[model samples]
Target: MAESKVLYLQKVKNQNVSHILHKIWEHEAISRIELVQMTHLTSGTITNLTQELISHRLIKESESISDSVGRKRVNLRFDNSYYYIIGIDIGRTSVSVVLSELTGNIVDTVEYGTEGITNPEEVLALIEPYVHKLLGQAESRKRKVIGIGVSIPGPMDQRTGKLINPPGFPGWAGYPIRPTLEERFKTKVFIEDDARTSALAERWYGIGRDGRDLVFVTMGMGIGGGIVQNGRVLHGTNGLYGQIGQMSLMTHGGAGAAISYDCWENLGSIPGILKRWSGNGDFRDFIVQVRAQEPHAVKVMEDTLRMLEASLTSLINLYDPDVIVLGGKLYPYLSPHMEAIVENVRSRVFDFVQERVIIEKAFYGQMQSLMGAVALVFGHVQENPLLVLGAD
Candidate 1:
């Protein structure tokens, strides 16, 4: 009984310390008195925890500021230069790796095409050097690589950390992505679905940062979504929460099933728009023709945006997010018609929902997924400071 009580008290103290550390990170730099006020922790406890964090090199004291005449108070800030995080975005067309500081500022980046790559072995080999290259940079800077975050296509089993049969990638079903990366990197690895990471990136670093409720929709190679409610990414059961691409527009779905079997992806994805074109042109050409007012391209895009409006209406009615963020290759095509799209969506949905929900472009643009990876690592550290501090 006594041992259990001691354990409970220790857990409580660790939680308080972690909370204080996160508060410091959020405020960028804050005084000890401010931490005490914000966290409502006792001054002695704040002093002791901050000193412990400083000793571990996770945080440090900055230059003193004059709080009063003849009196100075030291400010506490996260030691951003002390550690580094690697964020990897594994898209269908390319793989991108970024080395970011503890504060999520990107330091360096490398990208490579996966044109001929098919299997997990090839992916592992392709990413290995990029990881090592970034590690070399970290060594030169005298900073340790603390964590690696990966954003891959979805239907992942979050509990097992295994990706399950992601679309557009053959033989990726049940791939041991997390364990494989952990073994190679010798550090904690966090994996999330690409769309979810994009949403998390927005929530942690961009426009969605100030709001807890937002939905991120990706319409590039495929149509998908990520939902953030009350500042938490909704993983749902089996990590399939935000597979909005599969949302059925008809009674029966998938190819060759008739018009009643269509899904949102078939009508709204960038590839979907390209399918309507007779020429062998890619998404870029399709966008070019649309801008040139080519009749076929313009008609396809207008129809696609109408489909987008219907799908978005369902999403807004269901989730009621504060903002609906749009991204992917299709964004460029949609931007010019945003006013029309917004008006169309408003006409279809309820007045209250249409008035409240704002549709905006992705804040970080192409960097959203990679930055989300960095944020994932930082979130883990914030939740378990002891793990990073070598206490657990």
Candidate 2:
């Protein structure tokens, strides 16, 4: 009983230390005095923890600053070399791997085609060595690879860590991504819906940081969204809260059972548009041509915007987020069409609701999902004492 009590007390102290270290990382450059105030930990405790962190090279003291009152304070900042994280964005056509520091700076990146990833084992084999090589180039050993975060297209089961019948990637359904990656990397791994991961990226490092309640909509091969309320990603009971592409928007409820057009993905997803306009060259390429003032491309652009507007209007009415961020590979083409989308939604939605919601494009662009995966690891480190102490 006495040993158990001692272990519990030690665990509590470790948790506090981790939380304090996270605060320092978030603030970037903070003084010991400020840390004491922010963490409400005694000066003695702060000194001990900060000393341990500095000794481990997890944090370092910046050059001292002399205040007007003849007092000098040392600023503490995260030591970028302390560890590294790997972010993997596995999309339909390709997979992108980024190696970044704890401070969120990219060290190196590699992209490879997924044309041959029909077998799940093959996909893992391709990813594993590339990650190893990237870490080798950085001269970072396995111990320094803190975590691996994966972003994939999904109608996924977050709890079970399974991709549940994702329309975009047919072979990925029920894939045990977390365990597979964990086994390969021999480290902690996280798997999340690409849209939600993109939203997490925005919240942590992009525009949504200013707003507590926000929605991120990705208009790409498939249309999907992620919602952040009160600074937390709201995963529903089945972890599918942001799978908005399935929301029924058409009056006819879409073509037929044989066609699989009932979901919003069939109505507004990029592929859906491509299927609708079979005569068109690539829809994305056509959009670019339209933006450059090609005449035939104009009609395609108009029809795409109208379909997107229907989905946007439904989301705006339902979530009523403070901000709605548009992103994904297709967002560039959609930028010029933003005005039309806003106009359609404004005209359809309740006047009072329309007045409050603001729509904008994602500032981070293609990197949003990748960065969000990093944020997942960072967020986990922030919350877990065992991980934090282990990292230090």
Candidate 3:
């Protein structure tokens, strides 16, 4: 009975501490009084936890700032400079590695194409030296690395931590990505689906920061989705929540017999859209032709964006998010047509939902995935300072 009571008390204490830490991070720099009001905890508890956090170097006291009436109070801020994060994004076309501070600022980066890469081991081998170089830079700046975060394409088994046959990259099947990195770096590693990571990047560092519910739609070699509900990534039952690529549009085969179905991603993806064009040309040239209103190019694009409008309408109906973020290889090209797409989608959705939802391009542009990987670590650390710092 005593042991059980002790365990219960410990769990409650941890939750309190974690809650306090999150409040400080959310507020950026906050007074103990503000923390007390926000957390609904006793002032004594706030003071003790803040002091403990300061002692552990997770947080620090800032210069005295005067509030209204000139009463000076010391503010507390997260010590983000003390720890570094290594963020890696493994895409079918390329692999990118970044060294970032807990603030989601990238300090260094290296990238390589995956054209000749045939296996998961090769991808890790490509990442290792870049990681070592980034760590050296962090070491020179006296930053302790907290962990490594990876963004990989999905169909992953969370229980196994192995990617199970992601699209485009057959070589990565069954690879123990988490354990391999943890073993090599001698530190904890966190991995998330690429789409989910992109959403995390948006939630923490991109245009979705102000949005309570956000959806990031990706269009590259493939179409994917990442959804954030009330500031947390929505990983539904089995962690397979955001597979929006498979959203069906129509069925094929005989009138009565069922056959393979056509879906949103089939025509909305970059490659799929390009392949549909009757004439062949370079991607950049194709974009220029579309912008120039070349008859064939414009026709192909309008058809694709109409499909996008349908899929986006489906998304709006399903999630009713505050904002929808569009990104990946196809977005820049699609930017010119965004107004039309937005209007078309709005016309089809509910009146109440139409006015509130904003659709915008990703602010981080090409770096969204890498930023997501870094934010994954940032989120984990901010949520559990003691666990992350090995103080628990």
Candidate 3 residue-wise lDDT, 72-128, digit = tens: 999998776688889999998889998887778777888999887878888778889
Q: Residues 1-392, candidate 1: write the lDDT tens digits.
A: 99888778778877987788767766778999999899998999999889988987889999888876768999999887688989999888888899988877888988888876778788778889879888887889888898999988877887678888888777688998999888887778999988988898887777765446999998888888999987678888666787899987743324676556577887677666677565467888877887899988887777777788888888888888898999876687678878888888888888766677689999778777778788778767777777776643
Q: Pick out the ten consecutive residues of candidate 1 with the lowest summed lDDT.
A: 250-259
**Candidates ranked by lDDT:** 3, 1, 2
What TM-score do all the candidates reach, one by one? 0.89, 0.84, 0.92
TM-score of 3: 0.92
Clashes of 3: 0
lDDT score for residue 86 of model 3: 92
Clashes of each: 1, 0, 0
Q: RMSD in Å for candidate 1, one decimal?
A: 3.4
Residue pairs in collision within model 3: none
* Model 2: how far residue 274 lies from native, Å: 1.4
Question: What is residue 274's positional error in candidate 1, in angstroms?
Answer: 2.1
Residue pairs with backbone overlap in model 2: none
lDDT of each: 0.82, 0.77, 0.82
